[model samples]
Target: MSSSEVECGPSFPELIRRKRDGGQLSKQEIGAFMRGITSGSIQEGQIGAMLMAIWQKGMVAEETVALTQEMMHSGEVLQWPKAWDGLVVDKHSTGGVGDKISLSLAPALAACGVKVPMISGRGLAHTGGTLDKLESIPGFTVTQPVEKIRQILEDVGCCIVGQTETLVPADRVMYALRDATSTVDSLPLITGSILSKKGAEGLNALVLDVKFGKAALYKDLDSARGLAQSMVTVGNGMGIRTGAVLSRMDAPIGRMVGNTLEVCEALECLKGQGPDDLEELVKSLGGYLLWMSGRTASLEQGQEALAKVLHNGAALQKFEAMLQAQGVSADIARSLCSSQCDYFLHLKPAEHKTELTAQSDGTVVDIDGMVLAQVLHALGAGRTKAGEPINHSVGAELLVILGQKVKKGEPWLRIHYDSPAPNAKQHSDLQAALLVGKADSYLASPRVAEFILPPKM
Candidate 1:
């Protein structure tokens, strides 16, 4: 057997039994559990049972630590050059609607002299995926061999790609089992799944954007905070400097939602002309990451440094370079990044377009993000099951921002879709997403509500 494959250990039922009844597991026991799956000694049914057990009876700090470490070690742990230490960094998001922060943040960080080997995944259920967004660019490649990935990092300073086959193999088997078992939201399992892949990347520091709101995985602050704390502790325990940003996901992040539309918005963000909320998130997340890696004196200073790159054209240049490094043609990359170029000319746009208008006059209060995600998912922008193909051109664009006053018959949202367009009910749902409230109670909420840092070791 290869050294990366985990070795089989003690009784599987014994570990399941101990965890089922709320008993703590030793590091050796958890290691065995992770290895058994990686070694093919564990069955899927038992894996499901243990997932439920972890869901029902939560893990203690030590057990969580063991599970994260074991999962990370179940496959090949990536190696970097000696000089890259403390300069390699990454950011992960517990996803939400229209969350395309990574698209702008990774390349921007690279421009700041950080090495970003970003491993991303596809969209499942309602939340959009970074890989899916990047795929909208005709020739952008999301997978690269280790040698090429290293070269890209050395040249471009950043590369967003998928987890290699040998990287975090244990999480591959068990992570798939999570959704089917209804234990998808379990805290320990989430930490293990997220941090394991990141740990395999040999990162020196990590930042998490753990979202919470109507459209977020955790619907409230307390639930999201618990998951964030669990991830922070587990991540730090695994020897990676880690922290989290608690951001609200009540509405779609930018002026757009879906694969291609988000890519366009992200490009605009790269040019320092995107929506206020989207730009804020990129700066806030990237700023915290820079501070976590000790590149800046404070979080605010880190933000200013990042913002400087965005407006000065350095970050956008890195993004154009990243596109070509990842397989996009040089001409296409340059044109798309150019200020005078139109994005839709080079990228695919939907076959049909429909606009929705405001029916009454009032200040806009809420635009339901969950509603938009579901509608867009139905329109072929998302996948119900893994490996299902999505329509990159299918998406929606907001014509008005939150708190804007609109008169009757004013166009509020424009949807792009293919033939067999949205039915009456779907159209109604889209209209329902926009909510207007009296102007008296207009209070603009912060996109980033709180920043949670790791405790000093």
Candidate 2:
């Protein structure tokens, strides 16, 4: 059947009913629904119903591929010059707290000779967003026209920006509907939403950082693995080389957990001196992309190359170049890279503060990332809804981390705030989030649990 005929063939209600009853949808049926969505022929109610149905019944691999492809084609699919071949690659992480890998990884990959056009989003719920962190820099902008994005990529080999309204219209509508309908967790829906955007970017290769545990989108390992596998399957099925790594998010990836602070932490990582877990995660994800794009012979080799750029200051230079390309002053970027402490000193300090000291001498067994993120959100570090303002400077800092032994009077967390101090309940909650136990009971968790590659063709 012709594409037009497919759109005219099925009634929207019938399609929803079929999927609701566990019936597999044909490519034409899925394509028709997507077109209806893009054209406004499908009402929001209908979309919500279909999403709920799919959430309940789930979708098969083929159905997911169809949805992703249709969404990718619903708007412009970016195309680079033929001469550039396929040096383009990008990474997407299932949101997590203190997950600022993109800030460093983009420039790191670009320094390794791959072009990175990273389209990021804002913080939703407890997970922090890349665009939010970038905007925390003085005079840095996240919104840009497509021509400008192209220009920045050509000049800097990378640009991290938000999704343009016209880039993938279908996913934009579907994402809002998913957010409203509580269907964000469906494996197929996530696979479609993520790959649709990445596919639309016209990437040569893609890396998926699927995180699980208390602070991540998926709370369990099995579910996170399923989502990762589904995304890889659909992405490769659509011809974009994809790989995934399952990482633990039981604790925040780095020491800082707020906007400006996370950006500062990323700057430290670029200079070869951030938290070990954050640096290692960036290397693992960047190395996979390098290997997938054939920049390195193997993952180990790719990591070695990344390490070279990091230690030799090439990655930091690339990052500064990207910042300047985005309109930050060269002096400011250089100062941020060279002396972050001095750079931070100029920013206004929060008006109120409180410190939480260790109750007894012991080892830090766990710092619940989800609870900490919630506390940060309550303190105005993150947005509870879209378009809300983030405090940027107001957040809690972890003075002690996992497996560290602390004395009774040692401070483990310091809360920075601008207004009234945290009330009694907030104080109790913050204290409960930190777990201290016997020194020998501390068992550190591995950061990278498993590395998954696209299935053999």
Candidate 3:
């Protein structure tokens, strides 16, 4: 038989079987399978089976690169104008509780001369999403057509919007299957999903914040490191400058941990007055991005530049421009920045509330982020499944930080809820999540635990 009559290589099932049996897949096979996924030639069952196979038997670095590259080309790859002078950059975070870094980081970078066309997603499980937070601002839309996105980037130097249907459509299909099949934890699948969307953005450089601890997607440091390394390798292999920061997520980053509350906190950060931990995170990520794009000579210099922009009101101006470009009225945008109280009053209030106090005088050793996130979800701050509506006003606030000494009756946390009263279990869980001990036994957790550099050429 001629080469065309016999078909060139292995069939899709044969490729799946090879991977299932711990055999490596060639680049052509990977491309063929991903093309099948995008064209609907591959059935859902076969896709799920292939994902399970890859999850059980991991792919090597080369294989991962192939998968990432193929998925990236599965749909429209955006082409910016050749005359566009600014460097295009963006950031991604492994989902974490109370992580509003992107909200401020994008505009901050734009203010420093880099264009940030950020593509964001909605909240999943206990973590808050950038799109959800932006949606909290009345008239601030996350969905935009490609031409509008390009126009916003050219006009304001930054634009945060949700992924368009034409961009990385294959990743969307695969991600839904992964979520349903419990295959979301696989490193290769994660790398493919994250980079495919980011790569479609036509980024000049990328910074990743891979968080670990009780509240993060990867709960342990080692696993988080592995994921970070994988993403950095695959990202640079595909010709994008990538760096990863391993941050601690044992407790919420800022004071607030819900939708609207987080937006308020992020706004304060843009104004240069927010929680210390949150500020440190934003500066570190933004600094790396500036360095990667060659805007600064060193990381320290990048950090200093970011600080200057934040203090000189440049960052806030860029943020306001982005909001206005996205359809928010100038008056409402200023009102949101000046007084968030008026905005909160219009939303449904979490009328039923309770304060969690210290049982005895001691220092707070730890606050389990996972537990607090669960409590927030139970209070309707997050969705348990897709398509569920979230109550933006319901959440908890931390009154005490790690290593802070507390009196017996001092409030440690405040739980806000829409229910008449929190049930006994929620009350108990809230109390249990707070671990107080002797002052000498308490040790503060580092905000940025480790930094992973890009792969060496």
Which structure among the candidates has the greatest lDDT?
1
Q: Write the per-residue lDDT of candidate 3 for residues 101-187, one digit (tens) a residue.
A: 998889988899888999998887878889888877778899999999999988889999998988888898899999889998899
Score every model by TM-score: 0.97, 0.96, 0.95
Which pairs in model 2 have colliding backbones?
A: none
Candidate 3: clashing residue pairs, number: 0
TM-score of 3: 0.95
Model 1 Cα lDDT, one tens digit per residue, 49-154: 9999999999998998899999999988889999998999999998988888999999999999999999999998999999999999989999899999999999
Which run of 10 residues does model 2 get worst, by summed lDDT? 1-10
Model 2 lDDT per residue over 257-364, tens place: 888778878888998988999988989999998998888889999988888887788999899999899978877877787744565653445677789988888899
The lDDT per prediction is 0.91, 0.87, 0.85
List the RMSD of every prediction in angstroms. Answer: 2.3, 2.1, 2.5
User: How big is the positional error of residue 435 in model 1, measured in Å on the Cα after superposition?
Assistant: 0.8
Candidate order by decreasing TM-score: 1, 2, 3
CA error at residue 73 for candidate 2, angstroms: 1.0
Off by over 4 Å in 3: 1-7, 83-86, 339-349
Model 1, residue 440: distance off in Å is 1.5
Highest TM-score scorer: 1
